[model samples]
Target: MFNRTENLSLYIKKYPVISVLIGMNLIVYLLGLIPGIGNNLYALGIAYNYSISQGEYWRLITAMFLHGGFLHLLFNMFGLYVFGPELEQLAGKLRFFSIYFISGLLANVATYVVEPLNYASLGASGAIFGIFGAYLALVYHTRKILPQLKQLIIPLVAISVIMTFVQSNINITAHLVGLAVGFILGMFQFTPKRIRRFREK
Candidate 1:
């Protein structure tokens, strides 16, 4: 299964950023498992909370790369593999990265703002969902250009959202916030003029 997935991932060479991001996530995850090092990895999540109150707010951006457990990293990386390359291909790497990081940051901000006291959240769901939103934007904008893709987008997003709700211990707020931000950003990122310009021959 892993080999097959890797082979499939290779086809997305046009989107180098996705691959690099995935690699970074995996590396961090592995490094986090190194006994004492793992504690530091786990701390990255809560570190932001401490930093925020101390006026060193940049930890918000740093925490997105940290995951709490094997499954957490798995799901986030898997989601990125599933949605990220497509967005990268459509928007190009720089724009895709921007949307991803910004959306993730927004999700973190939402979490921090809404539940200021409960500060144990981590993972790249926000950024991945941003990619999901960007994908939605791309599909919606190009719906007229390529109507067939609509069938794929709607069902995939619906199923993912439903599954997110069903899964326990999942940060529902982060996912929703990420999706919402992604959807909103997708609107502007996939504007008609931009899409037309990107697709120009």
Candidate 2:
């Protein structure tokens, strides 16, 4: 049964974007593990505010795919795997990509603005937070479809708050900004026509 569940069509037909994203992240991570290539990649793309100021602007996006370690990669990928597909199916591919990438960039920008000059970070936490915020918005907009999600609101917020304080390395600025951006975007009332048709299947 578990094997059958793993072979479900939603992964292939509905969540191609998520599959591609995870594949890209994993490929980059593997490449980073090769000798000498790691430093070069980090130098070119990691989100060090100082490096970004010097005109390596691509770091803003590249950093989203770069992980600090295996556990970092695992957590971020897990979040994406869990939260991404339903939202993607609901919003359609283009809008889903917009929410993920745009919110991530804005989150990095917020971190740069609020944190110290020497501060540096990397990972998809901000993007995941955006997805989380988007999910919150969806739950608000379509409460009747998945009313049980309402139970998650307080715990999610409380956990975010607690994690921000307890974990010194976590980027609270990025997380909060991403969540705010996603929430605002989600308020735009964008239920894809495909979602309705797909659900009827």
Candidate 3:
């Protein structure tokens, strides 16, 4: 029989950065569950165009850790669990952190620019999409080494993007922008020749 706690412990040890990120998101979510705090947290955490224009710049980063509900937290964490550790392992801790935060903040900023003045958004979907996009770039750069990854990863990302249309209260703009940024960053992070040379050294 498998022990869930034990498994989680092992996973945390194996992927310290991802574990810390997940822990941070979960901690913020739990803190936001308190009665008065949730609304206040949202006020600070949600990225609204007007609020940002008024100097609420921190929302760009804070929004990524806030969730509207348990389901939202679960879905985003599931994505992080599935994609984060592997990417962190490949990119190393600093670069992985860069990809996650930079792409997430940029995604929110992009949405702020294009969305309505009253529009507000929060969640980790942008960062998760960035991770997905990075994977696509990794596959592209290493196609010769892992030719089959192209077929598998591309369709997966495409389908997920398509599914976003049927959903409500989701920011597709943020998702796309995050993905684009991640893909662009990945091109540099995982170039085949570069990786191959690193491996050789």
How many clashes in each candidate?
0, 0, 0
What lDDT score is found at residue 196 in candidate 1? 77
TM-score for predicted model 3 compared with the true structure: 0.91
Q: Per-residue error at 44 for model 2, in Å?
A: 1.3
Clashing pairs in 2: none
lDDT (0 to 1) per candidate: 0.76, 0.80, 0.85
Q: Write the per-residue lDDT of candidate 2 for residues 81-156, one digit (tens) a residue.
A: 8778777877778888888888899999988888887989899888888887787776676577757766776467
Question: How do the residues 1-201 of candidate 3 rate in per-residue lDDT, one tens digit apiece?
Answer: 012333787898877888888999999999898899888988877887789989989988898999889999999998888767767767888888888888898999999999988988999888888888898898888777878877878887988798788788789999999999999888888777766765575
- In terms of lDDT, model 3 sits at 0.85
Regions more than 4 Å wrong, model 1: 1-13, 47-51, 196-201
Identify the candidate with maximal lDDT: 3
| Predicted structure 1: lDDT | 0.76
Better lDDT candidate (1, 3): 3
